[model samples]
Target: MSAHIHAQNKTTEMERNVLLIEEQGSFAVGGKRIVKDGNFDLTNPLQPDGQTYHGDHAYVFYQVPPKARKYPLFFLHGAGQSKKTWETTADGREGFQNIFLRKGFGVYLLDQPRRGEAGRSTVEETIKATPDEQFWFTQFRIGNYPDYFPNVQFPKDEASLAQFYRQMTPNTGAFDGKVITDAVSQLFDKIGEGILVTHSQGGGPGWFTAIKNDKVKAVVAYEPYSSFVFPEGELPEPIQSTGLFGALKGVEIPLSDFEKLTKIPIVVYYGDNIAKEPTQVWNKDHWRSGLEMARLWAKAVNKHGGDATVIHLPEIGIHGNTHFPFSDLNNREVADHLAAWLREKSLD
Candidate 1:
């Protein structure tokens, strides 16, 4: 499909899907009735305007307290997941709603270009996976760490787990965080300065974009994909992947460049529960990049003054909470702490 047509074809699916309890129950999407024991993809997982990869973008809004007043915080889901990942109520944790709202932040969740309904095709092509092929999703890592770490059961509510697809979206595409940064800049202009928070993969681009815009005054990145550090001139292992080898070669946009761009106040939520030790690089190597990114962000902020802080949530535990941050069994506490932190930070 042509880019123009594809860009305009993004589909907005806001249905309240009912989830049937294992013994007996139902779920609904956007207030629509979901039959008991019946299964469906509650999140349409693709962008409505057809922009795939990190290509499509939009502004999501939630009003804060004070009778219709909006605080306008930006909410982002992790990779391989939609903004729904932030909204779906889990066993113990409240979604972003309770987490940010209770703290007085007006929520503005984002559907990153190819993620959710925005990213379907781009993600498939990136991994070179067949559209019908089952994306091998591993959730066993959850037991070892936090509940927000991709903790939900797949094919949930009686649907097939394979119903969800992986994104072929490149962590660093031609798309910069500028697109999102610009959107939030405007949102802040309208709603007043608010916290900008991101989960998992969304964390990477969030910094990329935040550094470029001044309006994004503060950040609460939950273990964003760190694209940092070279091993003493050797390439970071994740960049050496079957897919990333070429895309990352010859490209070394230092975090210093980001600092030069965005001097805004910010904070990073590192998943202390997770580790980036070289011994675990094969699969968990993504942290290498994440830490590197954090290092860069930290350096930039320190140079710019008391502009940012990187907080570690230990009770959240460090397991495989890479892509999702609020999923740990005790993530509600993490979120609560995060809310308290935001309450104290001044985005102005």
Candidate 2:
């Protein structure tokens, strides 16, 4: 699901597209549009009942236009990650934040249930402690590298790390897994309607969130973890060791059950190195979770007669580069490509 590119025509195409989109906003100057004040703020709409505290539950509104669009996007980050990761990290390759904003899609960076937040202690732990949901968040285990367990540790020396592994939840992996999904589902109820942009482990919680709200027009998942499990079958062997492996062990709702809930469309993406081809060995080993998840999504969508596409992220490279080149020499090319992709898709 990835492709690499050169800086020739791709750069030109990206620049041309950016200019074209920018020009569409009559008030843009110096290639930057004069944004109408998007004064959206973060607040705890959900009261501290069982699991959450006064300020523990929060949501951030990003670039909401005064005039809302037909479809907006709500983003939920993975564990130990923040909404800002999308703008700065992820594929370390630039992507579509600008296009989505200019297109008038209201964006909410919901704080999916995570550690370092009070929800873990109050809500997450409490929920999982009940006998009714014992298997809810205790499925996946860490394979191969035992060092990665309690399941929150980053790979020690993964050969080389293109991006830093996000931090770990304080103690329990169960709370870390369940809290985000709960936060996302609840957030959906509050937002009313929108699209979703999710990645990694956020996939499980994200899927549940999307199905909870019929107003969601579409969903784009970046190598969503366990996306392939949606058709409802046995979880793959290797993946069964993760801390959040309950879905595989038959603990929670299956994507099959929520087929009718996806009111609009859904798409998935996985990254690839610019150097090798799709399914290349390096990608499979280095970014195995993403690629495998892409395949799972392919199967899951088709089982429900759902339409989905797996783009080789390298081919869709930001500025025709690969492997999170932000620190490399080709960052500008990557940025331009990312800007262009957002415009092309009319997404942010």
Candidate 3:
């Protein structure tokens, strides 16, 4: 059942079945050593149990068509989410995976290290706690009980909300920039050249990955909370420059790196109601600032000779979209919009 069968087209003769390749592996760095216990009760003398290998576990699922597009698309989910984010919409409609597959592009979905199928890592030692569902409910902009967005698209009933919550994985609020960047870099090493589609927290690591790996042709970030741009000489406020920038671990992106982004196109998408009236209960408090910073960053990238543009969906007549657009009810329409943009860039 993992392999889906479809009718082949006469002209291109693409294979009828959707070939799904599932790969599960761990990328290990550092070394292993043997440690002795004070009470020497060694049942197994050859035990190499003490090891310091901290790296990412990748659950990469590739959906490939016979006549695939020139470049594959890699989907990276944001914090506390899994590769499932790209597979299906919240209302149970198709997601970007099938949409892109129909467009002749292969898709690679990743369960980030220490998440989903990637499971546990020693890095969890650094994490003290995980946020509750209410935190996600408000932060993800789904709703805040009685004060939900006027035209909220997120499923509001208890059953649907429970399903959405199931997609939420436990994550240490702390993210090690180096570890994530390294893992994404490794992914690029495997895929060579492709496009990166990142959501929410995935934005920071996505940018870092594209910069570190020249094989990255473009990036499409949807509500990436981490900002990538700042004034040249001015230090950015925390959210603006607080996260990973390129390969520089846990530091603000340097002005010089702006030039590097010119090699590829960058498009950032922000859903409607970001700062509009009947404001999202959480917008004024948290989301709007990072978005403003993203706009400023986009301006900086364009000025520095990079192809970067930020799109506010509402301005373009696309309305009622939430932070997670790909999973919204009008996801296919949104996908079409992005596909058109990608074609304009000669990426489709």
Candidate 4:
């Protein structure tokens, strides 16, 4: 049967009775306590006062099916997003969380430090109201401002677009790779062995977490941004960017630490509308560098005997996908592809 038909059948089976959750809950991990020294006055609410605060943690919401697979999937969202990215899609369809749950896999969705439920931070950062929705719409490859790509898989209705824009959030603290990876490693320690699934900016921390923790059995990254990590001496030259986009640079790690990733299977996926060559357009330019860097990163991994694969959806006959393919209208097809990969890798 064709993949589309197979996906539809799976959806029907899921809605009927397959999606049975035996356990579900939430937790916070890897935070530190801070004590402030001052005098407190009840009469002056705004006056300086001594207090204790706990912050800089990662929050997780998990659901386990009745007969879950051996390895759970821990999902980490990209920058300016939260666990919501794995929940309901903008078009009101079931997101990857439910789809994978129906496939009998435990799903752990995360809200990284200083975002969403984990918004409290050790250091403060101001969040200004930036009117950049249109910019992001294009950056995400849905289309240029006020227009979507022809026959894009994204929901084109106005309401769907509005919902998509509303999902973007601001961080309460500055982005810190160490902080994120530390918390994620702690989470892996708590959860035991599982697959690390990351999107965009989360990919950097995802790699570091795997290096820091032995519990990461595999990795699945979706359109990871500019944070590909390499062994210290094997680092590739930074991919230069055009216009306002910053240069894409590979992060460095000790050769021994980098080899840890080789013990597990790794796959990186990219969506459509990425330029094949250099471009002056900001959105296209940014992703072009990202794509190039991903290939180089994969090559380096394989050179060290690591199993790594890079896939571009359009090259494989899947078309019109945006940056958020996991939440796109054809998401079931996308999920099915991942399911097959998991099975092939014996992770399911």
Candidate 5:
């Protein structure tokens, strides 16, 4: 189906899905029968029944119109964010969700386990307090101290900044990439095949998903920390060895397994000002370095008989976009290009 054919729909439909795995094995106090009150009550009231499932629930917003793309688009948000990041832009404009829906792709916006509505899991140990506004203000490239990224696209007014800060969900506990990977793998298995879209730290789980599951037809990764997958000197380690570096699940698969991705079409997008280092301000050189490594990885993928493309927005004259371009001022334009790329790949 042509991408252009999708806009004819006047309304979009959406469904919220919760994917969970039944908890197995014995709990500390569960299974022990205790006689309490006038009747028998299980030792653990939480699990009065035999077995309880850990809520490694992946909360997904599945949205689409009557006419949609053949492959669904799964969007994974970056660290310190929930699925809300994809629902609306920071400036209160429609986000990637609506853009892709209009273009006819069934969009699945995922709140990975432990974030947003997925809630905390029983297996998780502790939940960290949400950072202060200043932390996110600096971390998200909204500003460094009182200064913003040069020509930064993030809304600069006090009201807008406050609104942006509200979008942040508390940093839950440490995430088990294995759990997330398993959840994503299961979702893909249920859906059969679809395109994966990831941003920032989300790229970790995204990479693991694509490598382990053949159902991932393509990936549109927006700035996955390159060091996670293609680290310097030695190759990146397995998930079990590194824990969940970059918020991805650990798996038995080694970095060498990335070659399997040759069968999966992939595109990595980097935003503007990545190389900017203005004296005392925060140096964004890491972003540039990561993109460079991503470029090498893409080259290696192509060499190994797979196709991967790395795009630096500035190089294409699409500048002034922040790390979160999908929520930036040029979001629609960016989404349009992304849809175009999918259509070009014949996956739309």
Candidate 6:
């Protein structure tokens, strides 16, 4: 069936089978306790008080399906997003969380430190009420604000756009890569072996988590934003930006630590609308640099006998996908593609 037809028939006449799960629960991991020392006046409403706070943790919600697969998928979201990114689509369709669960795979969704349910932080940062929704709309490649790209897989209705906008979240503290990776690695320790799935900014910490914890058996990243890591002393020249997004510099890890990535099968995916070459447009340039870096990263991995593949959806005849293909109108098709890859790699 054509992509369009598949999208149009997303909801079928036959009812979806009720999902059966063997286990479901939530947990928080990796936190530090901070003590604020001061004399407390219980009778005074406004008095300096001594208190101990637990902060800097990641929140995870998980479900293990009946007869679950050998490995679970741990989903980490990007900047300005939370675990909700993998739950339900802007159009109200089932998102990747349910999609993968139906395939008998356990799914773990994370709200990284300082974001969403994990908002408690040891350090404080002011969150300004920014009017940047339009900028994000363009950056996400749904289209320039107020206009949807031709035949884009995103839901174009006003309500759906509003829902998407509401999903955007602010960090209560600074985005520290080490903090995120530490928490994720701790999560892996608790969950045991699993596949790490990352989207956009989450890809950076996801990589470090894999290196930090051997429990990460495989990695699947989607449009990883500007966080490619390279071996020490082998870092490539920074990819200069064409617009406001700064130059893309590869992070360097110790060669010994870098080899940990090679032990797992890795796949990177990009959607449509990203320019093949550098462009003055900031939105397109953002992804152009990402695509270019993905290729170079995969090459370096393969050079070290690592298995890595980069997939541009359009190049594979799947078109109109934006940055969030896993929640797009044709998300089932995208999930099918991933399922096929997992089977091919003997990961499923």
- Which stretches in model 2 have alpha-carbon errors above 4 Å? 1-58, 88-99, 115-120, 123-176, 233-258, 261-263, 274-283, 315-348
Could you report the Cα RMSD, in angstroms, for every candidate shown?
A: 14.7, 12.8, 6.2, 3.7, 8.0, 4.9
lDDT value for model 3: 0.70
> Can you give the TM-score per candidate against the true fold?
0.58, 0.54, 0.80, 0.92, 0.78, 0.92
Worst 10 residues of 6 by lDDT: 6-15
lDDT values, one for every candidate: 0.46, 0.44, 0.70, 0.89, 0.69, 0.90
1-348 per-residue lDDT for model 3 (tens digits):
323234324212422344333332334322122344444336854554542343355567777765576888989898878888998766676788877777678888887766776655544445435557776666666655446677776666677777787887765324555566667777788778899999988888788887788889999999876546443574444542222231121235666665667779999998865654223344433556557667767776777778998888878988777779898777877898888899899997
Residue 32 displacement in candidate 3 (angstroms): 10
Task: State the lDDT of candidate 4 residue by residue for 1-348, as single tens digits.
Answer: 697587667656875675778999999998778876886667875754676788999999999986568999999999889999998999899999998998878999999999999998999899899788888898898987777888689987899999998888889999898899989989989989999999999999999998999899999999998678899989898999772568888999899999998889999999888888988777777888999999999999999999999999899988888999899988988998999999899998
**Where does the lowest 10-residue lDDT sum fall in candidate 4?**
7-16
Highest lDDT model number? 6
Error of 2 at 265 (Å): 1.3
Question: How many clashes does each candidate structure show, in the order listed?
Answer: 48, 24, 0, 0, 6, 0
| Candidate 4 lDDT for residue 178 | 88
Instruction: Give the C-alpha miss distance for residue 141 in model 4, angstroms.
Output: 0.7
Better of 1 and 5 by lDDT: 5
Q: After superposition, how far is residue 341 of candidate 2 from its true place, in Å?
A: 9.1
Native-referenced Cα lDDT, model 5: 0.69
Clashes counted in candidate 2 amount to: 24
Q: After superposition, how far is residue 255 of candidate 4 from its true place, in Å?
A: 0.6
Q: After superposition, how far is residue 327 of candidate 4 from its true place, in Å?
A: 0.3
